[model samples]
Target: MKMLAAVVVLFLAAGLSDSVILTKCGLKQQLQTSLTLPPNTTNVLAQIVCHVQLTSNFNTSAIKTINETEKPHESQGPRRGRSAKNVRPTKVTPKPHLESGEDKNEFWTLYGLFQLSDHVVCNSTQRHSLNLCGLTCNKLLDNDISDDLACVQVLINKMTAVIPDPETAKHIHKMISLIYQPECANAKASVYFADCPQP
Candidate 1:
């Protein structure tokens, strides 16, 4: 019995090792390499770092499920005609259980560091999704963050394409603020990146 338990523990640990919790500097480095910011927009990197810290606390496997009831009418299909400027902040809540014969217990889940959504971004087996990111939700939950960064890049491109040059930075900042909690809008990098070594 002791040997069996040891094996079981090892197996569980191995399974849990798939995800990673990145440090502030580590994440900043990853973003620096993965993202392509607009010209003269270096400050946006700090904001991006803060946004990830607030959203998932740098946990690569972080998952937040928003039930259909919380986001009514969104379960039908991908949200269309919604620009980056109008994106709403995600409301984090515990996964709810619905009784049988009730509406489908579909949930629009946010995955990984950036909390990319299943309804509008990544595809999942749970329901019909737009899959704008053209990748699986599971892909976002691993130690690898290339897929997450790619999806974010797609969003940034879309946002910059519509807005004029003068308002580009403001619009991008506003869009980032809207996607996360209200506090993220005012978050300072110094607060979150205090532990990271200066460049």
Candidate 2:
């Protein structure tokens, strides 16, 4: 019984450690400075930072969703026996927009698909690589057409070694295929805007 308990505890510890590593690797801000430079300019560090940024964004969004769901809203005061109408709704500031609808829709579609791809890619790997490519590829799909093709090529190399689980790989493959869909490819010919594209 004691041996069994020890084994279970060790398994739990290992799982906990992976969770910590995943959390540490997933924050977008953590990798921002490092990923800004071209991948070739910084060598392995840039590639690693890029991969970490993609994965970190996935984890950040997932955690944010969970936190938001569990968070108690002050607006729900009536549920807590206070007068609900007395509580003010939280005001959200809007972000600036500069792109036209077609371009915005295309960029957003790529953004959402990349987020989904990161989750699938990360799930299949036994160990995470710092060279994950989803977000970098998304840049190519967006209106900003000046991103270095070499950068995309380098990021692509990062995921090559990963042997993804068959099921998730199918989904990842599908999302990737959408990137080159005729409409999306045609739309990319025009540079939609010159400013930095928002993530």
User: Estimated TM-score per prediction?
Assistant: 0.66, 0.22
lDDT of each: 0.66, 0.31
lDDT of 2 by residue, 1-199 (tens): 9999999999998755422222222322334432444444333332332332332222222111111112112112223432221233232222233355633321111222122232322222322322234333334333232232233333444345364577545444543342232212222211211122444
Give Cα distance to truth, residue 182, candidate 1, Å.
2.4
Q: Write the per-residue lDDT of candidate 1 for residues 82-152, one digit (tens) a residue.
A: 43223443445556745566767555577888877776667787766666689989999998788889988
Best candidate, TM-score: 1
How much is 182 displaced in model 2, in angstroms? 4.4
Give residue 70's error in model 1 in angstroms.
Answer: 7.5
Candidate 2 stretches greater than 4 Å from native: 1-113, 124-155, 158-171, 194-199
Off by over 4 Å in 1: 1-12, 67-93, 97-107, 163-180, 189-194
> What is the lDDT for 65 in model 1?
70
